[model samples]
Target: MATCAEEVSKTKLVVAAIDFGTTYSGYAFAFQKDYSSDHHSLRIYGIMSKNGCSQKAPTCVLFNPQGKFDSFGYDAENRYAELTLTNEHQDWYYFRRFKMMLYNNPNITWHSILKDDKGKSMNAIKVFSAIISYLRQETLRNINERVANVGIKENEINWVLTVPAIWSDQAKQFMREAAKKAGIHSDQLDIALEPEAASIYCKHISVSRRERQETHGAEGVGLEAMCPGTKYLVLDAGGGTIDITVQRVQENGTLHQVYMANGGDWGGTKVDEAYEAFLEELVGQNIWEAFKAKYMDSYIDIFREFETKKRTISPDIENRITFTVPPVLRDVYEEMKNSPLSTTQGHHRNRKLIWKGDRLRVDVTEAKKLFETTCALIVAHVERILDKEETAGTSDILMVGGFSESPMLSNAIKERFGHTKRVIIPEEAGLSVLKGAVLFGFDTRVVSLRVMKHTYGIQSSSLFRKNLDPDITKTMVKGKLYCEDRFSKHVKKGQSVRIDEETQTIDYHPLDDREEMAVKVYITDKYDPEYCDTELCSYIGQLLVCLPMDVPTSDRGVKVNMKFGGTELSVRATVMATNQTTHAEFRLLE
Candidate 1:
């Protein structure tokens, strides 16, 4: 049996997880004692919605004129809307779906700034930290209210924060710093990839045998029933990004990633953007821009209404899709164009656009078109993954996250691969990541191995060769020729590494009597990159090792060891002369 290596199940009395999503956010937790029991259950945060209890609230935050956190989630949305209705929200800052800013941002750091819904600027870290703080408070309040005499101290609780599998290392580090600012100690927190967490949740849950047979045919029965060596695909379709991961089960009951996580920004928000684009064209760009600028509250309300209707959209629906059109939209159009909004209807080539009193009616055909591009891209990507030799024999595609709840997208997947592959959408798919994160906190060893997405290495200098080293990169060090910016690869792309496995130690000598040697980490998409400064290479983080003054100049060397198996990269250096190990943390997002 695999023992708990982290503090979650051992030293911590509670394991709480926060799913800080792009469009929605929520928390779940279970006591340690309960976690050890077979009857343990996760207490997920929920708020009442039109469809009943909602496991998550909108991922939005409100700040006062002083730029201090005012509220978050549903409260923030409501408060901002109320202020907007009264024309008093101009001074206040409101941020929605701001998490996407970190995605693909190479220069993202603690000092990065973010613009609010009204273009007001604030420190991005502050905004993220405030949201995390609110969630932390909520988690504590719930734990206190639910349990008796638990007396859970801050040190006794382990926290898990979920991020998309496709997020960059800097983004993950940024979240860690935000959590630290929210009063979570670095040691007590663990970053869980969204797709991996969802996989862990599926691993523990059982589907009805009859339902599994009806859906999967002869491929597999359910997630829990999958024996060792069974490979499947996980599509984490969230609001901001669709993260894909191919996983295979091990005999030890742990997941082994067959392929690195890969996906694009083709998510639910893309469909919303498509709908907005249609509306922009129908109302005229000038009118729509002015409406969003002046009537910001009503503009938000329009999308809020659409979000509710978006869930109910289906390919089989015959009636025209209807969206409540705030009166301000027409007023803004009239004010700008000196005519009713309907006048622009004739200008639209898409004859399906029509105005029905207080509602905007769109033909089912046009509405389906909104999902066409995103669905097509997602399908194509999935097909490409399945076609790869690595993902061969993968018969099941597990869909999780908020976007997976879309009937239209679900239909798209089923129509495309349902004939040959089993597409399993777990119950309460949106909460899968959150619940699984809680489980991950309880046992961090559920994922035994992972395939590296990029080739990771350290920037180094070695003896130059005329044929292999470019002339521009050749430089003299201590009267000898050396090649700068050489990539000393620690782990290659597509390489499988067990959890906490350390790479082979490489010794390095300080150049030019430098007091400290900097281990600059770089990553690349290529399997083998020779240079670190190439177009395809990206410098991620660095670790500095101090050289001992007592050691001779030539003997001042450090043996660097890097652990590339976990969600974050860890480095430790051993002094060559003293044989003493110095664990150094990467200064990520600096």
Candidate 2:
């Protein structure tokens, strides 16, 4: 009925976003037609599990003894539990909440080793690739079911992977390589900064404004309430890290970052750790260890229940919060304490511990204290950002993340900043990053500007000056005096970089008679440095350029270009003689 060209032109553009979080992971996508007509209708969904439909799946992976991926998410948890029953889990690799490894790793690379829960080590790239592959397959199946008679092609779809804005370039590149191994082409993949993605999605959605106005005052309801150039702060509190950034809205609905992205490991999972510590303190450490070893399924169950309860807890709640204790843990506690867990024992000796059926009830005040450690850190970081000179005039705070859904956290933030700034928590704050990533895939230019996290540059030689430069860096090249380790800055720290902005071009020549040149890329926190060996500076990666075989050493000069505006750094080198150009493959230092 239609020509091949017509049929080809009818191919749809689908955007799929994979939000790989530290404690959880999920995928969300939208068809271009649906997103363009009405952005509000584009509801982001995640993989369904037997337990229920959730916005994210637990970021847990289970691999067999052969080092092959067995299952992921709840399935992985269930499989590991089954294996634990037979004492076979020791040989299998089970990784859970492992995404933070990249963030904490100072020298993250593609060849890094990731240790699992049992201390079993595997290639980080393989581990990430397996998880990404599972998500991709599951998402593709879901897409097939959603659309009828409209077959999707890989080229027609754009994929966006979300990464923490605070992560280093090596970490981001590691994710990119892992995605490529999972079958996504490098050209089709776009990396989205978590906080920026969340901001973009919240900017378009009006529900947050409507809900805020209905609950709080009508002032500072949404982006529409503020005039153009008005600034606001976005706090993306996830399971592993809380990233904060200040951004101003542009006239064309674009966004510009006002401050560099910053935050720490104070996230929702910190509260879980506090709760676990409470149990360890309530019962002796030996008993707690035994309980964990013998009743891991029960341990997971307790936390799973706590996860649900934690979200609903508010500072105003009068009743004591209760959690179901596994029978085995209860037995262990009794055996260790030599008495039953009740109101008159352990840390809360004066308070009454109500035992309703198999559940342990704790006072609301005690339960609320568990959240204080993490919530306090979040508030402190937000205040620090607000105190910065760059964040001046920021009157609104947009809180989005799984942790932001916690009633206690919301109230704490509101109580602290309610007088000076309006706090807006969007509905389903957990899915904001995933959905916003999908929006980013559709249009990467939504975030018009970003602040450079670090000063990126290359190590090159410059003519050594007697008075201006140090003697240690002086070297002789081709009988010419030079500073061998001179820091050639491509982008300075805290510089405002617009989307697609390219760094200034610099010319480089082969150091030796060899026909190849190596460009060493380095990053530092210092404002400006004369040498790359300064404090807080580290070598990240290198780019190799090969000259034509017949070209002379003098003609082997290459023009190097670097771009630091996006989530990752990009480098391109062109031979000056033949005009041949090639993208540099950055190899991270081991």
Candidate 3:
């Protein structure tokens, strides 16, 4: 007879993934039966949104004056704009497209506070927890309403949250804590890297030749080109950051990462910034600020339209592009400049600005310039990844994410690597991460191995060598000379680690008569470091283990185990004398 715990463990019927992107966020889920079927037979479902059944919604959140979450996604945008119209938004908190702050933060902690668009500060954990709770509630409601006759219990569903590969461990932990506050247990949650999830999703779904022809023309090759053991690059270009990784197909239909993930803030939002800068230069900063302050809603609408238009602009576009300027902006411009608008070029002759019946006409050449810096950086980074010694023989590139759908970016990559590599842009590139994350929750083994992004280790005291050890790191404990802050490396950067692989056991003893021992964890970008105080090395967190008071100091030693195969770091401490083991809580450094 099966026990209750056994039954519940075996009854995992659903896998849900939340793709919390920088500019957009959404959730997707799949039933176990459907996912286990043939790739062609599997039918993954996304959250049904107001603007049709879409995979994602805008990553926007609005709070009331009392700092309570009022709305999320597109609804939040509308609600904030409505409040702005009544001059009530000054006190209310409105955060839009703000997920990049985590990526850019150097010293993120659980107590970190985030600033709203208007510079109002709020507890980041509360803000993130509220957004996650809203998504969870909506997902549960959707499951009950859409899936008929399937009384799915909360325990039967597995949740996967997606994060960027370049994020620090502290950032990942912050998200984990936020999710727990949203009512999801740690056991039911899994952290999936954005690029890895997209790779798995693409590997399972076989893109048809006809679909490839429609997008990539006759030269387009689908997943059929990738046989077992074939290597390919995954470029996940989202709104805020671009993440690039290389993976190879395994014989059992899994993926193995060939190169460590690498990217930067060169995503689609950079282009938006460049466009705004161009507008500021053309309209003058004073007039632009006035227009924005007086017509905030109109400013948002113009960018909303640009979001759609941006995807259609191709490298081959020759005609002058036109953007409808709000009447207020035109009136403001005239009032500030004290003259009528004329067809004149600003700074560049090829880039001319003309007004045609309340519409701002820009040259296609100039519009393409806005994407030059970001697109070039993406292409250059991809080139460097392919040039690596480990990435040899890789001939296919898979582009995913919302920004990957841009024709300008797609054309740029194709033009650069078209001769040597076949670029495969899967259908609905924007939803790849969201759907791939769902597949990851179903079977994490799909990605067999991952490369360590940083060299992780513990700061410890070692026998000091007179010549090799620096005097600055020398310390005396109990009349014995030791090298303090010595970095004990467990995992090296760029080292390929299999899933769930544990590092060699490290022995630790309590210092003096203390009942607790603190293990300071440190990480560095360098492959090897002598001490934690070296450049590029940072103290991330510490794991504290309590020792039994009755036991002698010699018997109070504990064995520390670190596992780096998964996305987040896991540590366990086992007392040698009592043989008792407990998970270590790594509190982020202040």
Highest-lDDT candidate? 1
Question: Lowest-scoring 10 consecutive residues by lDDT in candidate 3?
Answer: 1-10
All candidates: TM-score: 0.93, 0.92, 0.93
lDDT of 1 by residue, 25-70 (tens): 8888887776676623444442223334356888899999998889
RMSD in Å for model 2: 4.3
Candidate 2 off by > 4 Å = 1-12, 43-50, 207-210, 213-227, 334-352, 355-357
- CA lDDT, every model vs. true structure: 0.83, 0.82, 0.81
Quality of model 2 by C-alpha lDDT:
0.82
The list of candidate 3 runs beyond 4 A from truth reads 1-10, 37-40, 52-55, 208-211, 214-225, 343-350
List pairs with backbone clashes in candidate 2: 343-353
| Candidate 1 to truth, TM | 0.93
State which candidate, 2 or 3, has the greater TM-score: 3
lDDT of 2 by residue, 1-590 (tens): 00111123234378888999987899977887877788666765544444653568899999999999999998898888888777778889999888988889988866799898767899999999999999998888888778758877778877788999988777888888899899987777888899999998888774485456756677776434445787999999999999888999999888999899989998898999999998787667899998877676777788888888888889999997887777778788778778875543234546456664567888898889999988898898899889999999998899998999898898889999988987888888988899899877777777888898888888998889998888998999889889888999889999999867778999987778765677787898887877887767888888676665668877878888776766777667888898898545566635
